[model samples]
Target: MYVPPAFKDDEVESIRATICSAGVANLVTATADGPIATPLPLFLDETEGEHGVLYGHLAKANPQWRSAPTGEALAIFMGPEAYVTPSWYATKQETGKVVPTWNYITVHAYGPVEFFQEPERLLEVVTRLTNIHEKSRAKPWAVSDAPAGFIASLLRGIIGVRIPVTRFEGKRKMSQNRPEADRIGVAAGLAACEKPQDREMASLIPIPA
Candidate 1:
């Protein structure tokens, strides 16, 4: 993705945090037929490689997985985002030259892809993924929550994915290009928004009022 220096996010820890917080992402692959993408919930093993490895699953019937990817696959993780109106800029009052923009955080990871059907590994992946999302629930579900036969049958209908992220790019465009006064105005406007995501993005702006 094209990113200006002012908006570039090069901090490895911060980038990893953004990916983790995103929870779900779009995994894209190019095939002889065309490009295919699937939205997936993934787990990252940061210790695995330079940028770390991503693990997830897709439906066994999803044709996207059957087609061999010609090149590296891409995973996009998007975080908090908020709208910035011209009115939310000091320049709009001073010179009326400000334009509307958006403040958001995102990460793009690219790597070679591998798909597997190992039942034991699939079982482990499913269990950890389930625990990650269900830990917050009062009554969390588990892979063993179902009958042995039923769980085994269900696992047969899915495939596991492992991609070692060779490249990681992160972008955090939170009004860093704006003047201090404009940044403050935008943050305040977003904080006042009724949307929880907008409010969350407002809090992420590094430039404080």
Candidate 2:
């Protein structure tokens, strides 16, 4: 991910938090034909492995899963991000050396990928994933809410994916390389932005404890 030392975020909990907040991830695989990617919602089981295990599903007709991956798979999780303009840097006024950059959080997880379509396992995966995303709703839904026959028929149209994470590399480039004054300016500028995502990034900027 080309993370500089100043921008590296190695905290395990922090990385997990980012992954969960992402809700969906980009799953990439290298195949004999070429690289293929799928964007889908995934849930992490932190207790399953030394690192953790990721679970998700894709349409059964998606060719990306039909072909065997030739190498390790990568799941990319992205968090809040915002554009940082030179105008937000105090250094711009002092030395006119600052340039535009992106401030964001990302986590890359690598592991062997496995694709399966067993109906029982597929049902379990679907139920758990639904719970994770629906738990916060005022009127939460459940896999059992649908007729069993209907749900079974629907499961046949998708395939489940599992990845036992081997390692994780996370980066949080939140204006950490800038001076304290410059960082404060960036935070203030982001907080005042019209985009809600910019305000979310503002809350992540490190302020003096």
Every model's TM-score: 0.96, 0.98
TM-score of candidate 1 versus the correct structure, residues matched by position: 0.96
Clashes of each: 0, 0
Taking the tens digit of each residue's C-alpha lDDT, what string does model 2 give over 7-58?
9999999999999999789999999999999999988999899998999999
Q: How close to the true structure is residue 111 of candidate 2, measured as C-alpha lDDT?
A: 98
Q: Can you list the residue pairs that collide in candidate 2?
A: none
Candidate 1, residue 188: lDDT: 88
lDDT of 1 by residue, 98-175 (tens): 788888899999999999999998898899889988999999998788898888888999999999999988999999
Off by over 4 Å in 2: none
User: Which clashing pairs does model 1 show?
Assistant: none
State residue 206's C-alpha deviation in candidate 2, in Å: 1.2
Best-fitting candidate, scored by lDDT: 2
Q: What is the lDDT of residue 107 in candidate 1?
A: 94
Consecutive 10-residue window with the lowest summed lDDT within model 2: 200-209
